[model samples]
Target: MAKRENIGLSRELRQTENRAEEEAWQTLRLLRKEGWPVRRQHQIGPYIVDFAITKARLVIEVDGGIHREQEVAARDVEREGVLRADGWNVLRVSAQFARHGDHLIEMVRAEIKRCCPLTLHPSPQGERGT
Candidate 1:
């Protein structure tokens, strides 16, 4: 269950999302329609991630110019450490790359495949039940 505070924060964050995040969300929505089960502004632990594939334990962060600041980058590193310790894979994409529709979707798809290849594809008949 999502914490009360995080839920509110997520709501606020969603409302103020940057252009890159908006583009990423559009791609995520398409992936969801294709059965990828993506969620936007999802709460995980004490943080609300930009996008999450819960089953695959993947967190996608669309970083804008602000993320390049030293303080923000440091905080991001700490947050990523915590999430990784909890067994999550974090993928960060720059605002510029994320704003490119095709590139963003392709990158996300590649990450998903890397994280959960077996679940996404069936074993060959000869390899099955081996």
Candidate 2:
């Protein structure tokens, strides 16, 4: 369980998140509604991600205008490398992906399937009828 203080902080962060972050949250919330176990503004190691799929060990980042800066880009690369080394798959999406619409969720679903094939498997009883 999350500490009450941490939970409050998470709520505050969500409330204060930028437009791109809010857009990403909509798509991530859709994933959660679909039972994908997605979380928003989740902390991992020393960093906080825009979204994360806990079971799949996947991190989704929504990059905005600041990411265009050379220093920020370099730091993002390093952050991704560290996450990768720690056995997490990172997906970086542009803010435009969110502003455009549901395409972003589709992309995330595709990445989830690619990274965690077990998510696509049929139940032990066997494949269900079409």
Candidate No. with top TM-score:
1
lDDT, model 1, position 130: 16
lDDT of prediction 1:
0.83
Per-residue lDDT of model 1, residues 75-125, tens digit only:
999999999999999999888888888888888788888988887643322
Candidate 1 local Cα displacement, residue 78, angstroms: 0.6
Candidate 2 wrong stretches, greater than 4 Å = 1-11, 121-130
Q: RMSD in Å for candidate 1, one decimal? A: 6.3
Per-residue lDDT of model 2, residues 11-124, tens digit only:
788889988888778767766555676778777777777788876788988898999999999999999999999999999988888665478888888888899887764234
- Candidate 1: residue pairs that collide: none
CA lDDT, candidate 2, residue 3? 60
Winner by lDDT: 1
**Candidates' lDDT values, in order?**
0.83, 0.78
